[model samples]
Structure formats: structure tokens, C-alpha cells
Target chain A: MKKTLVILFVIIGFNAFSQTANQILLNTYNKFSKVKTFKNKVHVDFNIPSINIDTITGKSYYKAPLKFKFKFKGIAFLPKDNPFLIYNFIKDSTKYIAVLNGTEKVQKQNCIIINVIPKEEGDVMMAKFWINPNTNCPLKMQITSKSNGVILIENFYGKYANLCLPDKTIFTIDMKKFKVPKMVSADINSKSTKSKDSSTKTIGTIIFNFSNYIVNTVINDKIFTDK
Target chain B: MWQLTKIELFKIFSKPRSYIGFSAVTAIAIVIQIALYADGKSYWDFLIQSLDESFQIENLTFNGNMVCFILLQALIVQMPLLVALVSGDAISGEAAAGTIRSLLTKPVSRSKILWAKLLANEIYTFLLVLWLGILAWVVSLAIFGSGDLVVLKSDSLTIIRGADSAWRFIAAFGIAFLSLSVVVTLALLLSVFSENSIAPIIITMSVIILFTIIGTFDLPVFNQLKPFLFTTHMIIWRNLFDNPLPTEQIFVSIGVLVLHIVLFLAITFYHFKRKDITQ
Candidate 1:
């Protein structure tokens, strides 16, 4: 009778552990997937020797899978591309969620890993998320997009709480993809050819840190619409 | 002394050629305005669209904002040449015309005559600049209609609110006048050395263009010399666009300009006093 009781106890403990792990993965992803609903500040750093842009600052805000806004301070947008700070490019039939290949690693006392890929080919290419195994919360993410290029984002440095959102976050850009359309203009192109051997490039750097972010706050609807 | 100077001033203004500078300013302002109006939207839209992916901006109301700023942008590189056309030729043109000989024969010292010419040229320059401010900014705003001022720098876009732009425009022109005056004064000094009006005008413009190229080249040699170049000081007007005034740099520019004025005027007077006037 005692042996039978031990076997039943072992089975229940195994089931509980399985449920917890799945719950942690799902909860962390859900919180991160809702990124567009929050107000956050981001810092973009870029360097390109060809066109000579080193670094600059810009802010990002999002409404959902379809609508997003980016505001670059002191930088003007070129005419060929869309210039809205918040862009809504999601189509009606587009998928919003997908499970990507996951990688595992131990961070401090907690073990966590994540895998994610874009639902569309034209959307951001790769996004890797790091979740705390014990707390079931996402702690950081590394993202790369074809449009803006590579970006690194991490939550505010603090102990992760179970199934809770980050209080503060920081976003950074890799600078390779930050391009100005005017750099490709005919005037610059001709000048480039003339001084093909003489031109020397300067690199610029910019860094930004975000604090006191409030998620699910009331954002104006007009921010997403065209004038 | 003042009376004689006033007569010379009157003579300069009474000539139809004096009005040419003002007329040219008006003509250029109108041409640029028309060109901007025709394609201003597309130009603005193109700029906004380029970085839209990074910064998803929406509902940027043009309402003549971008056009007003474009006018100012054009002036930064163009207005000094206009200033040189008149102020640079003040003494040189008179010498080339053989009018200086007749005027010098009057009951006046060479120094006094030089002062009169300088004063007259300065007055003309100030008036021309004021006229330009009115036509380029005020009249254009009226014709184009008032709105925000959208400024485009290398990597950023700055918007000055419409309500804030009026005073900003006034301040910008005020700073622009000070800068142009320095150019005018330098041209006046050059005019003293040349026999032909065109030569002084051309030389002054060449000097400015050369310095502008040097300032922008990013060479280690130029980086050291940039602070000393008058062209570097010429763009002091642009600093007013910053949220807070860059007072120290502005003061430095003022000091540099004042020093140039004094040095140029001193040289002009010394040269004029000893000049044989035989030619």
C-alpha cells in the first residue's frame, strides 16, 4: 500500500512541473507580443562608412500588429519612403503570432530561452526573447529587422517577478540599417564619383535609455491615421 | 561732417542702381516661392516617407510650414552674394566710373570722404537686408500663408510651431542682418583696394565660398581653422533655432565680426589718407 502511494505522488509532481514550464513560456510570450500597446522610448545608434552617417536619436511607439510610430529627432525623412512616426502596415489576413526555434541558457539562478520569427517575410526578420524559467516572465529581447536593421532591447535591471511585465526597458539600434534616402540622391551620387578616392567617412554615435513606461495607457487614435 | 556724409548718402540712394539690390531680392524670393509651391508637397512628402519605417509619424500638417523654412534655407547661401553686389562695389564702382575724382575735388579731406562712402554703403546694405526680410519672409508668408516652420538638418527634422515662428523669423532675420553686415563691411574694405566694382564683388564671394568649403570638409587642418573663418561666424543666425539660445557662441561671433569691422575700417582709412589719387 505504501509503495502504491509513492508512485501516485511521483506522477502528480511530474504533471505539475510540465504545466509550470508551459505556463512560463506562454505567459512570457503573451506579455511581449502586446508590445505595441505600450508607450516606450528607444535609442538608435548607426554607422555606415559609405554615406557617412554615424549615429542619431529616435523614439518609437506602437498601437498593435498593424500600427506603429517612430519619431526621429532632428532627422528628416526622405520622400520615397513613408514618413509617419507610427506606421500601420499590417494586412487583415496576416498572422500575428508564431512559435520560432528556441535556444536555452542559464542566467543567474534561473534558466530560460526563447525562439521567434516574423509572421511575414517583409516584417522584422528575427526576434529572440529571454524569459526567466522560475518567474515565467520575459527579461530581454534581441531584434533585427530588414527596414530598421538590428536592435537590442532589455528590461530594466531588477529581479524578475513571476508573470509580471518589466517596469523599465531600453531599446537600441545596430546602425547598419539606418539610412537616409538623400544619401542616394543624384547630387551625392555624382559627388561620390568625383571624389571616389578622396572621400573620408565620419562615424556618429547616439544612445537613449527609457524609464517609467506605462503599459496599456490611453493613446490618441489620431496618431495612427493619415491626415 | 555729418552734413557732407548725408549728401553722399542721398546721392547713392537716388541712383536707380541702388534699387537693383532690393529688386533682385524680391525677384529671387518670388521665383523660389513659386517653385517651392508647385512641388513643395511632394518634396515634403518624400522626406517624411523615407524615415517613416523608423519613425512612424502621422498627420504632419504642411499648411505652408515647409515652404517658409525652405525660403530661409536658400537665404543662408545666397544673401551674402547680394550684399556683396552693392556694398562691395561702393568705392570700387565709383572709382571705376571716374566719379570718385569729381567727388574728391570737393571741399573735404580723403578720410571724411571715405567715412561718407562707408556710411552710405552701410545704410544701403541694411536697407537691402531689411527689404529682403520683408519680401522673403513676410510677403512670402502672406502669399504662401503662415504656418509652422519645418527645418531639415543633416539627420533630423525640427518643427517650429506657427505661433512661435513669427518671433523666430524676426530673430533669425535680425541675426542674419548682423552676419550680412559683416560681409558688407568686408566687401567695403575690398572695394577700397579695387578699381572695378565687379572685381571686389567677385573676390568677396570667392573668399566666402572658399571658406564655406573649408569649414565643411572635415579635414584636421580645417577643423583647427574653422573657428577663425568668417564663414563659420556667418551662420550664427541658425543657432536661434535651438530651443535655448547659444549665447556664448553668439557673443564670440559678435566679437569676431566687430574685430574684423574695426580692422577693415582702420586699414581703409590709412590707405585712403596716403592714396595719391593721381590715377
Candidate 2:
């Protein structure tokens, strides 16, 4: 009878732990969703070993339900979809199978790791999030996609920790893995032998530094429209 | 030879058809510049949509340098037709006008006359490219102002600083002139075969169109054949924008183009030299 009681208690404890991990993810998502509008100054640094480029600085405006506009003076190279993917995933939590992968230290802070597998087939095949247990914020995220390969993003929080907004985000992408069909690659095929050799070893990284975040600011939808 | 070439140039410039190339270039450049000035932001946004999520661009100006690059891309394809219009008619048009017989009756050898015509065609090709450069690059700069040049290729995006891009444009135009010379020579060769100006022009354009199609077609069969096509080498001007600037490849492309020019010239010379003008 005592053995049977212990077994029941153990099962309850396991279920409780599972629920706690899921609750943490929900809390993080909820915290991030609260900011309806935000305007911030951003500085971008592209660290591409194969190419040379200067730092790009710009102003970015974001509105809830996916309206984003960036105003800049110079050319900037960036991944088009991953930022939205991160926001979309957090906004719609029901589409993913989130499971606790246990605890780990992220940036020397204790965090709970969650393995998220998409329920429906989409661009994102799977994603892993390292959530700061105390603040219920994502410290780091690794997303794997069929088309875009793997994207690793590290988030650095500042005064807006409570709001789940990062002051900076660093994105790393393996450029060599990105397959561009010959039809689309401009005139690279004119020097195909040389280009083929160099493309295999290239890696691209982009860093976003955000400041002066004015949250809940009124921004017109027309500003986001392509002019 | 110099006197003969001079006479040929005078004859070419005297014709009203010679002005068409210059007019077309200017019209196209102005139209494109105006359109870009009016609605370029929306067009650029669509192009950069894929990269927008990660990078925030700033101070993205549409200046003369950018316009020049765009003009080159849009106009290079059409430039061959302009070249063919004059060059394809070099011999055939003379024949059709009954001037070839009188010219052959002179003390000058057929080979020397052919050289003079080719030399005159080369000078015309050089002037046409220079006119395109002055109008497209220099005039656009005057209108739009100067800024960095951003080039978007299939697999990569290259941004060249405003100050550094001038030399690249010069080199690109130089290479473009060489490629156009190949077209001129090809047309002249075809001109040797016919007495009608229209036939040579049509034949030159047809050959170029066919080769370009074969060069661009993604089929496995076409892939092997692409390396051999002069049309494939024609776009090597774009290579100057590549980060490392594939020097060897550019040289090879130039070598191949020069080879095509030589071959075309040789055949035209051979056919003209042995021809019976009396018949």
C-alpha cells in the first residue's frame, strides 16, 4: 500500500513539473505581447567574412499584429523572415508542441530550456528556447527551418526585462548552406569555378543594437506602407 | 589606310541613321531616371523585402552612380541592335546603293578596303559607348547627385562606395565596348554575305538572340554549351563588382571575346578578298 502511494505521488510530481515548464513559456509570451507599439533607434553590424561592409544605423518602428518599418540611409543586408517568425511563434503558442528540455545556464544566468516542435508543417521545422526562469523571458533561441537552415539568436535584456524586450539581438546564419539556384545568382556563373570554391566557406552574422525604445507610441499604419 | 578610314567615318556620320543610337540612349536614360525618382522607394522595398527583417538600412540614396549601373543593365542588351544597325549595313548597304562596284574599281586592294571599313566601325563603336557613358553616367550624376552603388545579383548583394565605384564603371564600360565590338564584327561578317542591309542586321540579331537563349537556359545540355557562347562572355563586365574582382576570369572573358572578334574579321576578310565584284 505504501509503495502504491509513492508511485502516485511521483506521477503527480512529474505532471506538475511539465505544467510548470509550459506555464513559463506562456508567461514569457504574454509579457512580450503587452507592448502594442514601439519605436527605437537601431544600429546593425554585419560580420561577413567573405564580404566587406560598413555599419548601418537606422530607426525602426513596430506595431502589434506584424507591422514593421525601418528607415535607413544606407544599404543593409539582413535575413528577411526570422525576426517575424520569432514574434509569430510567441504570439500563437497553440501551434507548437512545447516540451521542457530541463535547466541550463544561459549567459551565466539560470534558465529553463524548452524544445518546441511545430504541429503544422511550416518554414520552421523546430525551435529551442532558453527562457530566463526568473523574468520569464527568452535569453536565447535556436530555430531550424527547411529553407533557411539554422538561425541562432541571442537576446540581451536591459531595463525592459519586465516587458520581455531585448536591448540587443545577434543573429548568426551559415551563408554556405543557403542554396541559391543558378538562375537567380546574378552573373556569378560567369566565374563559376572561383565562386563555387569561395561560397562553401562563407558565414554571415548580423548584430542589432536597439536603444531609445518608446513603447505604446502612436504610429500610423500608412508609415509602414511601401512608398 | 588612315585616309580610307577617315572617308568611311565621314560617310557614316553624314547619314541620319547614325543619330538614332544616341537619341535612343538619351531617351531611355531620361525615362528610367524620372521613373526611379518618382517611385524608386517602393521598387527597392520589394527587392529588399527578404533582407528587411534582420538589417535596418539607412541613408539609402538613389544617386547618379546607381542610375548608371541600372542604365548599363537595361541598355547593354539593346546596344547590340544599335551596333548591328550600322555595322551590318557597312558592306551590304554600300552594295545595295551600287557604291561597292565603284569602290572596288579603285586602285585600293579589297583587303585594305575591308580593314579601313573595320577600323571605321571600331571608332564608331568607341564613340557610341562614350556617348552612352557621358549621357547615362555623367548626365544622371548631374541630375540625381552622387551616392553609393548597390548591385543585387541572384545569390549576393554588393554595395560599392560612391567614391570607389567610378573606376569600376570605367572598366565595365571598357569591357562593354569590347563585347559590342564582337557584335559589330559579327554583323560586318554577315554583311559580307548579302547585298541587302536588312538581311545582315536580322541575321546578326538572330545569332545573338539564339546564343543568349542557349547561354541563359538552365537545362543540363545548355550548361556545357554556355562556356563556348560569346553571349556568355558578354556579361563579364558585371564581374568587376564582385568583392575580389575575379581578375583571371575577366581576362579569360576578354581573351575569348577578342578571339571571336578575330575569327569574325578573318572570315569576312577571306570572303571579301576572293569575291568577284563583276558578278
Candidate topping TM-score: 2
How do the residues B65-130 of candidate 1 rate in per-residue lDDT, one tens digit apiece?
A: 455556666665677887787777778888888888887888888888888777777777678768
Q: What DockQ does each prediction reach against the true complex?
A: 0.09, 0.20
What value does the lDDT take at residue B117 in candidate 2? 93
Q: Which regions of candidate 1 fall more than 4 Å away from where they truly are?
A: A1-22, A28-111, A117-126, A133-136, A143-151, A157-167, A174-227, B1-6, B44-50, B58-69, B92-113, B139-175, B193-229, B235-253, B276-279
Candidate 2 accuracy as TM-score: 0.65
Positional deviation of residue B84's Cα in model 2 after best superposition, in angstroms:
0.7
Regions of candidate 2 where Cα sits further than 4 Å from its true position: A1-74, A77-170, A173-204, A207-227
- Tell me, by DockQ, which candidate is best: 2
Lowest summed lDDT window (length 10), candidate 2 chain A? A177-186
List the candidates' TM-scores in order.
0.64, 0.65
Instruction: At residue B25, give the lDDT of candidate 2.
Output: 85
